[model samples]
Target chain A: MFGLEKKDARLLILVAVLVAFAPFILNPFPEGSGLAQFNAGYPDLMQRFVIFGIFAIGFNILFGLTGYLSFGHAAFLGVGSYAAMWMMKLLTMNVIPGIVVSVIVAGVFSLAVGWISLRRSGIYFSILTLAFAQMSYSLAYSVLTPLTGGETGLQPKITDPRILDAALAPGATPKANLFGLEMGSSVELGMGSWLFTFNAGYYVAAIVMLVAFYMSIRIFRSPFGMMLRAVKSNQQRLNYTGLNTKPYTLAAFVISGMYAGLAGGLMVAMDTQVGAERMFWTASGEVVLMTILGGVGTLIGPVLGAGAIKYMENILSKINSDILHTWFAFLPDGLEDFVVTLIYPFIGKGWHLTLGLIFMAVVIFLPGGLVEGGQKIAKLFKRKSPVDDSPDGKTTPAE
Target chain B: MGILEVKNVGKRFGGLQALGDVNLSIAENSVHAIIGPNGAGKSTLLNCLVGKLIPDTGSVMFDGQSVLGRKPYEINQMGISRVFQTPEIFGDLSVMENMMIPCFAKRDGSFKPNVFINMLKDREIVERAEHMLEEMNMSDKRHMHAASMSRGDKRRLEIGMCLSQEPRLLLLDEPTAGMARADTNNTIDLLKQIKEERNITIAIIEHDMHVVFSLAERITVLAQGTPLVEDTPDNIKGHPKVREAYLGETQEAA
Candidate 1:
């Protein structure tokens, strides 16, 4: 339909359906229900799901295709956020300019970083990127204090002159918007005990995520993408075949960096703030984890991984000891206490322990990641369905 | 005047003079072979021709253009393609993809960021790749992974990839190294066919006398970083100096 192969087009439609109906899909539990704490339908968390999905999808283009792992990807995201913040603070509250400028600024920054770092490959390249990200993080935290707002971070303020925007009312606060539609504004739909909240910002981010995903699909099928894969397969052979590997790798790095920047811009548009912590090495590592966990080379794997990680970060971390105790209150007091204590560490702030275990399990049993797991399950079901036909076909074939 | 001219090319590796005062010319549309023992500098000279090594004392020219300072891909774009000792195909890619990459490289030059053009939809590239795969007799294995293919198949694919580019000069470094007898014979036949079918210059560095005698029109015998003799394969075979320096050693080794 969109100049895509049949299978890819179907996958895109399926994802579009999933994203468009995410509020309902993610909020399966009704309000005040015991499982309501696990619901991820709220505007803030929903925005993050799509935003990081964009980030991981971009990361996949580099790490998946070219096998160039940039541990400094989040630096581009941070740069984008800062750029978007400045755009909102000075130019306008509308997000179009902020997002556009963020992508361009991040592309330029990544070009410089990629040019130098791509000279090395394998582990050295990874470490070089890590060093660049750390440097950017440290600089933004300290030396670039005036520009980055240092430890305080940056926020749109009333005192700042917004040249492209109308003057704020006497005491009104600046809110990020899309042509006057406030990002945070949401419409609530209540049906009996279930309440679904659809936020303007979440929809905006989701649409952007869809576009990014489509573009990634296009790239995956492109001649350029084939060359990138060739780079990963055998760079020496590629060079000998009259195709330069340097420019291809550099282009992938910059394109992925721009994707990260788009994600960072979306984050600011949703929340209206920028922080240096976003550029931390851990944030960069998170995107890598997401890409590997979902599926390294598969097109939709990164998005699934991003959604899984972000969903866990929000829902699992929100499960405090109090909630655990309440859920187990039906058991005898001592038994309930024992159960809660045993399960407590894996939930709430200790969610990382659970995530770590899941990551290990995925890597060990499903090296192809969650996508492989899904495919295996699908195969199992298909095999079961053909059981009746298989016996008859076997006997008839023998005859 | 030959397609490739190597004159007084010397490469030193610190205290070791790998290639010293070598002069050779490979004529257009001819198969030339370089035969040497373990450290006879055959590979070094091949490397110098393909831009992998810079000669300290000579000019390596291709079609009147200096190929000394250019990068490997640049040299390749200038109508020269190299096949490695080990069949250097993209193992992870499918056979058809391996064939298509060279076609893309041939069409796009060193680098072209045409990121939006669908590879499968690019009829020109697909047709050319299909044609090459057919020519290589690997049409059925197009969907199979390149790594999973047998060694002979990989070598065939690599040679096919080089040929798809229609390179004016094709350089092979031990093209049939580490192959079974049957596979070695198959490769020889393929090379013979390629020679008869294409107007391409082939420069081969081989350790096997059988392959050289069957394929090379002219032979250059090198002994310790210098060519001892260069002549028609039949003449070179009968030369006393060639027999003592190269053929006699192989005869004894046998």
Candidate 2:
């Protein structure tokens, strides 16, 4: 409906349905059950999924369409976080103002970075972005310590002036909210053995993510999106075709940066803190990993990739050797130890190693990421039919 | 005054003089061909005109405006469009999408706030692109990936794309350089049709004598980075200096 093709509209509706039902679906196991650990319906984790989804969606606009692999988007995210934290410190605890400030701040910051980095293409452009991001991170760590809160990080304190809202009841701590709706508040509904907990913050974040996704869909189907794809397809031809590609690219970069900022603002709204570590180059690398792992250019690929990585990072990392032992207890003593040892490097603190292996597998086999894998499955089903099914109506479905 | 004026334009790269004190005045609505051997600065001079390579000395003026330091896209916006030797269409896009880019550029100038408008819903752009493709006889291949097309089709699509921009000046760098005879003749006919219908200026850099002589009303022969002769096709074919520069290459070529 929002400038989307029929297929694109269908995709948007599918995503909306999925996001709406996530809390119920993810929290299928009842509370206090052994499988509850896998329940991703928790407000904190659920919030991360949508926030990072926003980040990845924005990144796809730049990298997927324009083919500009920025290595410094985390800097924008960090800038957004810092802006949100300051907004909370200076203004009211209304998450709305904080979110707005973060997007604007990140947009401006990315504009300066993109203006300089877009001067070069290929790896040189990536390195230029990396240099700018690292500079921001280092500056936040030391030189800009007073503003950034240095080694500690920025946090809203009760003593600091909050001019917008009524003076807080003297000794109360500041809490991020939408008007007066507490972000941390949740409603838990239990039916028989299954318990579903939906947090206000996660729903808010999910709604924002839906809007971000809808906007991306509009962009992907727009003439502007065609220009961006054109930029990636043949920039030389585009220049000859009389398009100044710099503006198109710069606009993409800033838009992606604003998305990063939105993600950052959401993170602080949920957690109420800003850290210099968020600006680290490794953080930028994480987004790249998510995009590539899920399918670099596809609509739902980044979100799926982000969910997979975040799930592994938060859930699998929590599984210690003791849990492995409990699961393998039925085996003989020697076999149990052997099995635990074998699976040890793929979970718990070694979760990153598992992530790396999975990433490598995705890159080597399904270079289009998990979206390609899904397409392959769809193709197999179509092949079983009598009609020669053009899966997704293209030779390559995911790209 | 001609529509395009090159006055003492020279470009030196290290010790090599790519172009030296080159002077030419191309009239409006004329077909001008620049022919030279390899490394004779034919490409260098063309690059200078399109602002791809800034000449080390002298000036190039198109439509009475200096084009010395303008960017390639900026030069294009000044109503000059170039078709590359290797057919530079967007391989990742469909043929229709490839044609629409130039149409969009022409209608919206160099840049537009076209982000929010649905491409499929842009009836004007879609019709314009479809009409251009129909004229190129590529209407059926409109939805095919541009990169998958035959070389002849690719060249045709590129020319169609350039023409869709409705440029005042069309620069063709060996439009039929690597084509079979059939495809070459097709390209020639296409150019003829375009010429009759558009009333636009064409400056082509070509190596084929037959193709050059058949199409060019006036020819500029370049040798060692300088214009050797500028004359009518009949005179160029018979002139001793032109033959001397050609070194009997045309006879053997024929």
Candidate 3:
């Protein structure tokens, strides 16, 4: 209905419903229950789920379509965060300007990086991008200290002269806001023993994520997207067909970079803080993991992947030996101790081991990622249902 | 005067002289064949014409414009389309998608960020692609992946992709290379049809005498990095120098 085909429109609506009801869906367990530790309905984690989803969606435009694996996307994200912080510190506490500036700044930065890095493709292209990201990280950590606030990063301060915003009270601290509504403010609903918390910032970010997703779907179905796929498929044929591969690849890179920047700006809008660690190589790698884990080219895969990883990162790491021991306390002393010890490495501080094993399994068994798995399951159900075939065992006629 | 003119074009790589003092002109709306033995510089000459290589001491001109410094895509934009030895269609895309790409390139030029417009809704591109597929007799396989098609069908699709652009000149590099006899015959028939129907110049590099004699109105015999003879098919077959350089051994074997 939104200028999308029926299939794509359905998918978009499904995602919108899921995101809108995430607070209730994520917090399934009642308050003070034993399983409450697994609840992921917190506003902070929900924001991250959508933010990283945007990052991976953008990355997919480059890696999935154009087949350019950029290892330096985090540099754009970091630059975006720093730009948003400076805007907040100087202009006002309002997030609209900060977010807008963040995208533009990141676009310019990525344009320069893409122009240089796109010269060499394949492994050389990957290494060039990696080198650029590392250089940016180093500059932010050391040489560009005055601008980036060095390794310490930047934040809004009461003493700073905010040209567009009024002075803060003597005893009050600055908070990032949209108009008069603070990002951290939330509404709580208590029904019997179950409790649901909904935050203003989470809804704001969710709306942005929905728009980003809709735009990505349009791009995937557009003529430009087909060209990007051509660039990936047979660049030589494309060149001989009178199409320039350089500009197409460069445009994809810059568009993806701008997506990463928007994600970075959103992070500051939600938290009112910026850090150089946001641009770390591992952060860049995490987006790649999310994309591959969900499904590289599918529209909804990145968001699912981001949610899966963030859920595991938050909930799995919270499980300790004590929690494990309590679950097995009914067993004898020695048996409980042994079980706790055996499971300890896979949880808490060693949760990465579990994540790594899951990643390996996804790459091996589900090469097309979780989306393929879901499709297989859907096919199984469709096969079981032969009601559509006919009442007398004859198949339906072809249209 | 011909549409394409190669004047004293010479190219060398290290100690090996790939092409030397080559001069040729391909007339408009004619099927021209370049026949040669292995390492005879036919491919090298073709590469020089398509902007893949710059000549050491000559000019390759198409329609009175020098094509030396231009990129391959720019050269293509100037009304030249090339088909590779192996069918070079986008293997991962569907047959319809492969045809639409060139149509888009023709309509939108080298690069256009029509990122928001729906491809299916773009009536011009869709109609052109569908018409070309129908013209190529592949409308039934429109949704099938291009890579899964047979070798003959792949070659047909590639030729259709080239024709969809309606370039002034079409270059075919060993169009029937590594094909079964039936597929080769099918390709020759397709090329013959293309030549008859379109007012386009066709330059083909081939090892098969059957294909050359069937399609080429004028023949150029190249041997050891130079043109040994350029004449009509009947005259080329009777030329003593052409027989010595290439045709004699093949005629004896046949």
Strongest candidate by lDDT: 1
Best by DockQ: 2
Query: Which candidate would rank higher by lDDT, 1 or 2?
Result: 1
Q: What DockQ results for candidate 1?
A: 0.49
Q: Please give the lDDT score at residue A17 for candidate 2.
A: 94
Label model 2 with its docking quality class: medium
The parts of candidate 1 lying over 4 Å away from their true place are A383-399, B252-254
Go through the candidates in order and give the C-alpha RMSD of each one to the true structure. Answer: 4.7, 2.2, 4.2
State the lDDT of candidate 3 residue by residue for A132-209, as single tens digits. 998999889998999988877898999877799888878989898999789899999998888899999999899989
lDDT of 2 by residue, A249-303 (tens): 9999999999999999999998899989999999999999999898887888899
Residue B95 of model 2 has an lDDT of: 87
Candidate 1 per-residue lDDT, tens place, B182-244, comes to: 999999999999999999999999988889999999998888999888999999878999887
In terms of TM-score, how similar is model 3 to the real structure?
A: 0.96
Q: How would you encode candidate 1's per-residue C-alpha lDDT over A298-372 as one tens digit per residue?
A: 888899999899988989998999999888999999999999999999999999999999999998888878887
The TM-scores, one per candidate, come to 0.96, 0.96, 0.96
The i-RMS of every model, in angstroms, reads 7.4, 2.4, 7.0
lDDT of model 3 at position A258: 95
Model 1 Cα RMSD, 1 decimal: 4.7
Clashing pairs in 1: none
